[model samples]
Target: MRTVFIFMNEASQAVEIPKDMQFEAVAELEIRREGDTVLLRPVRPNWVSFAHEPTASADFLAERPCVLKTDYFDLSGAGESSEEPGQ
Candidate 1:
């Protein structure tokens, strides 16, 4: 909706940013060229995606109970003691 002129390798050229655009004093942006058009977009921080509250309930841990006992088998000596019929 806004138009801005960007000059390449021109130090004297000045670009005016719209006042409605809100940003911090210092910000990072990404520029890309698609065909003949150029696109500019803000580079968000990595943590921004995880900034919101989780959709799952907070009592999720309490719903799943832990089992104290587990079953395991020992197969180390099973095949070692068995011999071939020809032997």
Candidate 2:
């Protein structure tokens, strides 16, 4: 099956996922704080112009077809990316 991956960035990373594409839990969101700066990094991520607002994700699924995945890293150990739901 074909897949379309979407990555989130610091600017819009805080936006809530659409209701249709809502998953049991959100994948881990990586945030880094240093001194007085904060950085938000997405797992590694688009827009569907033709889809209706409510059905955008469903439409996207129909077209390219994809499974939502969340990538996460273990900070305590090594920052290794993992495919497990929330990592």
Candidate 3:
């Protein structure tokens, strides 16, 4: 394990992370304190990564007709209700 020093200014504090311990430019992280230890965890985005080829055709949706189904949820409301305990 490596140890780094934290610097403080008049308003805020900063920690100069080494290049090897740095995250991506667009990466998001969450800092939490558990007892006396501080943890840095990455917050993953709700998205999927895909690549597009210039030579490939855009007939993916046309080949699959079942992708246009609109019956994804139950409109009958037969599940558990979301009422509060006191209500």
Best by lDDT: 3
Pairs of residues clashing in candidate 2: 6-45, 7-45
Quick one: ranking by TM-score, best first? Answer: 3, 1, 2
* lDDT at residue 49 of model 2 (Cα atoms): 29
lDDT of 3 by residue, 1-87 (tens): 898888997778778879987887746688899999878878755434323323456775566656566688777877668996689
Clashes of each: 0, 2, 0
2 against 3, candidate with superior TM-score: 3
Candidate 2 lDDT, tens digit per residue, 20-80? Answer: 7555454755678999866655533324523535544555645664565545554575656
Q: Give the distance in Å from residue 67's predicted Cα in candidate 2 to where it truly belongs.
A: 28
Off by over 4 Å in 3: 46-87
Off by over 4 Å in 1: 5-14, 22-26, 46-87
lDDT of 1: 0.68
Each candidate structure's TM-score, on Cα atoms with residue i matched to residue i, is: 0.34, 0.19, 0.45
Clashes of 3: 0
Q: Lowest summed lDDT over 10 consecutive residues: which window, candidate 3?
A: 46-55
CA error at residue 20 for candidate 1, angstroms:
1.5
**Residue lDDT tens for model 1, 5-66:** 86655666445667787455647777788999766678865676567646767776776666
Question: Measured by TM-score, how close is model 1 to the native structure?
Answer: 0.34
